[model samples]
Target: MTADTSVRFREFKMPDVGEGLTEAEILSWYVKPGDTVTDGQVVCEVETAKAAVELPIPYDGVVHELRFGEGTTVDVGTSIITIDVAPGSGPAEEPAAAEPPAASVPTPTAPAEEAEEEKPKGRQPVLVGYGVAESSTKRRPRKQAAPAPEQSAAAAIQAEMNGHGAAPAAPEDRPRPLAKPPVRKLAKDLGIDLATVTPTGPDGIITREDVHAAAAPAPAPAAEAVPAPAPAPEAVPVTAGARETRVPIKGVRKATAAAMVGSAFTAPHVTEFVTVDVTRTMKLVEELKADKDMAGLRVNPLLLIAKALLVAIRRNPEVNAAWDEAAQEIVLKHYVNLGIAAATPRGLIVPNIKDAHDKTLPELASALGDLVATAREGKTTPAAMQGGTVTITNVGVFGVDTGTPILNPGESAILAVGAIKLQPWVHKGKIKPRQVTTLALSFDHRLVDGELGSKVLADIAAVLEQPKRLITWA
Candidate 1:
């Protein structure tokens, strides 16, 4: 009897995943209620902390309910899915081979009350850290018991999850099905029954291809009997018009569209540009890369510029706050989600450091390196893509003079760094060679007025104009 006799259930809640993030939007569910999903299964993908992450189930069981729908922003610790384990199962134990209901269950009423009481009181009930309080006691042994009404109706539940009549078609055992909107839509449009589709993806996932094929019209049934009656003019012509074409918005295009729309709509943008003598800043970049303490750190011009911006942000925290419309208030944060505008094949994305204000120069350097690498690989999770207080768009890498880059959505400000070029300059009232670059600062005039914006911009230029002040960083 080492077998887990209790019918283990997985109350799969949303995880914060990083830096005390409290809420996430449900992008999609990979599993539905009454689905027989396995342990470590990706039951849903949630967009949290700016990244889209797949949540894995810790218990193997039949899903009982989908707590939320797509696009719903659920707080941490909210149960998105509930699982009901078969008898003779613990969290991950293999269910007994087709055994009848022979077990003991504690009186359901008390347990529900106790579970409700155990739920933490808060705005977001993220239950990841708290272990199952009830799992502390093992089930007491009992005689073979008759099926309860709930258990008897399990088949009815499964059929609903399958999205059809109760066991109308008992197809041979196959991988369980996902009951998402897209999946259901696909099944309906194709006239293909969901129960008949075999899932080949993780934890029995029915992929987009499966839906596509299912939606494809079945071949004509051998011209159907003696007389076809001209097939009613090919039944209104099955295909679209000759010039018609359909393209789904997904992957890089989808991400790009979303970013542009968000940035354009959320941030009230205003752009300002200033040419600067960055001679010292360029020289210091070379010197820091050679320093013993900074060895192995990826040194780029952006490092010094970032340091400059951070220092300036400390002087002007107003630029790093968010506008709360419903509350009719401006929320100022002590920490910074510093967004670095990255241009990739997927388009322009502004992923930020969670608390960039807390890191040293070395840590910041490492963070920048990792951000650049991850963005290039398209592996930047949805969590990395949010809560940006302000953004820095480095157009210098593309060898441009300067441009008024649009503000990232949800951000009030963006600074564009231009290319550094050797040019003639006047120092000590004389003409000489100097490293020149332009700095552009764009801010929402409503949240950040000209005075504050100009001061921050000037502070950044001053740091570049004289690079030694970085020694006294906040």
Candidate 2:
């Protein structure tokens, strides 16, 4: 390939999808070698620790090579694909174009020097997959080495093992076992060896299940001294078939687990619970459902419960704060990023409504509806899940009483709403069947004292008890 050639190739590196995320697992590839792709076209989908994000190709090009296959967890800065940005660059000519000229052919200087000469002058605009800091260093073209007979045989075996078109490793070293970063991390955590575990995934890849199976304890030996040559009884499997399934904690679930553990141990937690008659709140839910402003939006008991929590935060703004352990200070937030805990097939994810304190009742309801819909579809972006000041988890949907929920990391408080049931209660000096529910507020004791926590819970309960308080409180 001559440096003066007009055709140019660009390498697209994996980007950090989430804030400072180290790696992401490629879920699927939308394009392959030889396929034509346009700028801003989604080339692949990747699942980070927080959420699944689709990556768009930043420039128009014909795909030349996909460096990594689907299911591979690539680091943020590693190049994953090559694109021929120059028009009229045919797929068949890609290999020849990438190859250096013969030694006998005349050239001005070395390939690296030629690339340096061809490098664009001055500062270049940062491309989508490229990092902020641009490097002018040019890479020399790699020379193809002839393989020995033994190496050729080993390469064939390695290729078969990888199943997909991953390049084989060096002949002296065994090919690294194929597993996603999360699965590899799980193996490392359990001290299980990937080489020993049998792979069941496509292309002989180790899966999370394979790692767990390797971690399971072996059956104990019989204690009895058996007489010579007696036929051993057929060993019974310890685990019942399809009775129980073990899912490896990863992605959203793994992130939630880590955050919960950090919050539980780092911050001293204090929980306060209260049972309130929310008959008025339920009646208002029905009223709002019929109202013109709330039309075509999700108006439910949880919506009112969320609004009540917001009102309580407004009344007790001190509780809407976070503990800054690093800085040794308490950070009070004026605006509320209200998180609503959602349980999906992936796991528990809390996608918050940004600036919930600034939104009206109808606007809040619309945001809540959109948040729930996005979460249910597993399309919630990582940005929507960050910077939360407080969270409300409605356990009522599962027909359960309130739980002393753990505080979301960086947030001071979380409110749990229990199931609303009809119970006989004293109302206006007489026993009456009214809608009642329990509320539990858990907060970081370092930032919120028991008095403040109790006040916040009481405020929420009061708002629910008298729906008119929402109007007056605002």
Candidate 3:
């Protein structure tokens, strides 16, 4: 007896990489069909709304199929790749193309009387001899033949696959429009039926632009003879292909834009600004950079600024709270997940440190270092960005003054630190050159009133101004 050597195909689906994320875009594929892959090997990178994540193939196999192409956005749980686990054992195509033998196929040549006897009775074919006994509740009678549309579609496809020309199907019985799932979704969203969209893609498939063209309104009747309007800047066409470039917003940028927009509108934001003399804090940063305790850690004004903000939150605990609209409650958090906004090539991502309020100065500095490093490398996880109680965005690094930073969605407040510069200030008695910077604190008005917001801003300013408040205030 011959030992069975059959190919087994295993499909890898798009995973929900981020909490509640529904889809991800395939950024690039590291391997193509016929490439051998080992278990836990990174096969491709996908960019979800949160971040770019590398997906590892879970089993050793030869890649048999890549279901979607790169740049295609696929829904979670949909199979993106198929692997032939038993690659060399048998021919991969045999199993997929195998069909029942001719002898088993119901013969059309059977006599009418015999065919009638072979026809299923009231049972209507369930698991062999497992169907219900006849009763008043009648099942719909099965059709003797396949639906006309389905039969036409199958015939046309079969003809094409067999390398034979098929008689053109009637318009009414035309095969369902040829488009990928995403294109179909786009057509549906635009309220344009795929059947009505003209096909401009290879092999008579409907492209995205075809759908858009169908959705475009017909030109106004030429009889209305209106005077030609002056061409607008955007309306003028350029020949050099350098006038404007369009970038498709997806992945992190798209998510950040939506979240920022929602935060701006949903949260009643109240921003407070304060200019502070951070000459002492700047000196402390240099001292800390040299200190053995802070050795090898990123010791900068931003670090001290973060510490100042944490201290401010500690002194004004009421500012560390969230508004639960559904619960209609003000939830005060005991622990703070301090967020530091980092600008990456992808977009601005705010990955927070867990329990930052409990960490020592050195520990906080280390955490900040890791957070910024990971964010810069585009390796920050979604969990690190979630559950943030407050955020600090340092615009100073960009040589800008303070900005009214938007709250990071669910977080209560965001502190914006401005560029530190040497300016003449009225120190003690006379004007003296001092390192001064401006700070802007934006908070959800419903959670933090003007007084509470002011106190938080003031505490942060005092901590930066004195640098000793970190010890005494703590």
Candidate 4:
């Protein structure tokens, strides 16, 4: 086909969706070759280490080619797709044929030559936050060059010594096993070679189950010495069956696992539990639900509990801090980004409410509502999950009594709230039923001593027991 010289092609590269994320896996593509696309229209969805994010095309164009297929893990700054910005431009001249390269170059000089050859013909400024530079590189006419006899001889000798005389295989020409990044990682972790595993997934894709089956130890041969004994039938191979299935951990689950492990190991955690009577807090929750100001807002025990925690933090600002291991110091935060640990279908994600200390009760309720809704939809942004100072995990929602939760990475403490149950207790010197719940506070012992943690926990318990303490303490 003739080249359309007048048509300007734009390449869109994979971007770092989260801060410092180096790579992402393309989950799916919304546009294909020759499809008309508009500026700011979502072209693909990618799953980064943090979350699934939709990428929008920056300029209007017709899709020319998709460089990578879905489920491919592409590094940041790698070209992912090409678009013809001037698709209506008339076709121009036929491109010149590429000439054969000179043979027998020294290994050290090859990289430099490749770099020079790949240099762009022109450069243009990229859109902000896209994370890739625009290059206007045009194909240059190549000139054929013949190798020297001595150089060819040297290359052959070198290749012979390496046990491979054939030219390196092109990536597209080679048979690459079809598997998602997570499955590939699972195979690597299990020490199973993907090439040896039989794929069972759609389109000959290798799955986590296939990797695990490959990694399973083979049955040992029957002993020759037991010839007289009846022959033992071949051992049945264990397969992932109806009773059990293996799910590959990836995206948010993988990140959460790493963060939890790091936090559990790095922080010297000290957990303190207190059983508090939260009758007042429950009553306040009901009152807030009926109040005109809280109409259409999420009004629950968690809301008041969050407010109580903020008030407690205000009273004990020392609790609102993080241990800076790199700096070898305790970093105190002036403002609270209150993280509410949300359990989604993907995994446990903690998307904090920004500047929660500054927000009024109504505003905090609204933010909480939005955060919960976004998290349930699995659309919590990576930015929303960062910079949390303290976190609250309400195991109570699941009918659990209490738990000593591990702290989120870079944060000092996490509070676990248990189910509020009505139990018999002495009220005004008489036996009566009261709303009681257990609260567990886990903190970094390095930054928060027992006295400080106890005070913070006590402040929260006091506010729950006496709802008016929020106004008074504030």
Candidate 5:
């Protein structure tokens, strides 16, 4: 019986899907209790701070329990699901099939001291080579003793009369507003006090929507004493809800915010702008589209812009480096990981092409096409985003002039490509309509001085102005 019990149940913990990700929100569950799953069958899909990933179960069995519901951000090494390895092998398991034992369930509501004492000190198993990680164990905030019974009853009655029967607990008596990890993080990002939010979720739980609503500014009160006349026909009705919509900052967006903040404050930025006539480059794009080598590839002005930036980096290699604060050294990289900033429904993500300096024009186009497609599909991996040395952002696609782009964390420089439009310019002799665009290059001043930065920007503009430079530069 002991041996049978040992092999009867198996627990699957959330794996670190990305590099050192401490937690992940379970976006969806593919399996539920009593569902049969085979080894390697995907059981759930989770969104980490980096990207959305599907998790596959390792053991084949009947799904016995789901520890956390969908949308819960579970810590790494915590068991998310249990499987009955041997579903019907014993009579002892028959009575327990309907309900899992209390011992198997985690007591998150337990007192902090009791929880600390009860939790196992031994390290939990993780994927091989990942080693054991300290669980992001959150201790529930202690609740203060309730007020006198009479006061509590009166408060409850008063609350009931107000429609939302749930009485607001005393400041000290309020347990941590019942919220998931992601919701808590969102509240922190938005500078909202969760205790002040009125929870509408079932069972008095604070949700992301609650936090977002709290972050939204309240409507201004009317000052007039008398009734005001209705507005004219052209006037649009305005309300706080209709005027603005709030989106919870989490996952990739949250990460991007933190990264941009760090990069902006830490690095001294120097921006240089130049206007160039890209009529030649635009014609080259059409030529490339017709070429057999570039067929089936995404041939666009951005492709040439990316190539131009890479060529500029090759010419001014010193600009393609990072400032290491710890060692107080400028780490110059020989290979360029060209990051293309792509905006998605989730948020902005920069999944880079590795060793971009080594790829030919056609090869570069293919890589860019694949990267953009994968990012749009939300399949970009964390590995693809790491080790980026330089980046390019095309604001031209949005039909806007160039703006100074913020550098990606740990990268040296970022180039912004503005919209190419027909403008009158002094060509070889006369002023005629020409395809012109503005380019803005922003780099870390600590590593790249004005001359080097100017040179790099000039080279990119020069390449775009003359498409034949690609062959000469190579």
Candidate 6:
């Protein structure tokens, strides 16, 4: 086929993959200029406000160019890839005038009954499906006849209405909301809504003002971030002798402070704790560490527990969903990026293990071990700390029995694994030396409810209580 004279370039900009995520760091590029790509094929990996996301080519065409390299932080709506295509590219050219969206869809064509029959059973509704076949870029290729500006807008509108591209552009392509995922989550944690906050971010994006506006009470005087403890008789030591002293926050502690404040004000958080018998999990960890085949694998109970949580999330995906108000949708993830919260000299940090679901217990053990070591050494890269669906904070490492932990920003839930101890417990209907630990669950109540959270917590406890259950095979 003769190339259409002067083909139009479809510039696909990066969009906010997660709710309220504004910017992402380019992690890796899988395609380069002059390369061909198909729809739904991964072209690049981007670390978003919360997690590292893999972006797929929305259409089948030759990749004209990858605008940014790895490690670049590009804002949402910035065109990251370009595709050359004729206006009439995919499928047979239907008609110039498309039918009104769904509203005027033929009643005869309505197959609510038949379509419902084929819908997957027991599956929760999800947004961000395979994505669209094409996108509506701002640039318009020259044609034989010049169309009026109104007609161009109309045509672009039609593309969105027809689902050939993304939803219509926002009223203005203004600077995106500047709030980070952790900050957005902080607002969520505190039940603070962002829309109302006067955006201090570039352009008109909601700023921290939006959060302060919605909150009934202002925050305590800015002070240094010290160790946060559950309400206890021994009050946390203040920065100085004063009731609350100002201590300049920096590094991980500063980042954590900002995120906590944001999540605390915006999202309504709920926490619950459970004591569990982890004797079997400990035994399994010891066995795996001693296994010849598992040599070099950092086997630990935390790894087994992480795997159990992954399994539980698969069984209850609500724990892995994002609450997106813009689309009035729930984004349920199919993959796992498990985060392990670490307490380092820099303070509490969580660096995740990407694609945790694909890993075996041995792999998870090694990754977790490496993650903790890296975090403790203050050598964790930002990429390692990005894109977590669910997290587990091993608070028990500090000898704490159990406590209600704060929800990590962006993630829907975090499992607080308390200190493991040799305690007396009922075994075989009699008291015995049992390795025990407390499993505390802190979750975003808006995205995850008590029932769903309880179900997941119970599943994790069950697996740990009987580690042999993990390997029950025919």
Please give each candidate's TM-score: 0.56, 0.70, 0.69, 0.69, 0.69, 0.50
Full-model lDDT for every candidate: 0.63, 0.71, 0.72, 0.73, 0.73, 0.63
lDDT by residue (tens digit), candidate 1, 1-474: 112222344355667654466877666677665567765566766654444456666555576556677757777766666566542332343223222221212112112211100111111122232211111112344536654565334443343223333322333323234543334555665667777787664435565457656655663121111211111111223375566655545443565677777867776777777888998888888898998888877788898898899899998888777677788788888988788978764456677877888888887887788787777654465546767787788888999989987776667788999999999999879999999999999887768888889988998998889888776544
Tens digit of per-residue lDDT, candidate 4, span 97-187: 1222112111111111111111231222332223222232333444377545664534643443233423543444343466654466677
| TM-score preference between candidates 1 and 2, better one | 2
Q: Which residue pairs overlap in candidate 4's backbone?
A: none
Q: In model 4, what lDDT does residue 374 have?
A: 78
lDDT per residue for candidate 3 within 1-474, as digits (tens), equals 001112145556677778679999887788887789875566877888997776767556677767777778888767677666655443423223132221111211111110011111222111111111121111235469755674454464344334333444345544465564446667767777787778986547676668768877743111212223212113335469596866678889999999999999999999999999999998988888889988888889888888888888888899999989999999999999999999987789999988899888888887898788788777676767888999998999989988989999988999999999999999999999999999999999999999999999999999999999899988
Q: For each of the candidates, give the backbone clash count.
A: 14, 0, 0, 0, 0, 31
Off by over 4 Å in 3: 1-7, 94-241
The reply for model 2, stretches above 4 Å from the true place, is 2-7, 90-246
Q: Estimate the TM-score for candidate 6.
A: 0.50
**lDDT string, candidate 2, 144-189, tens digits:** 7655566443454343223322243334435446665446677877
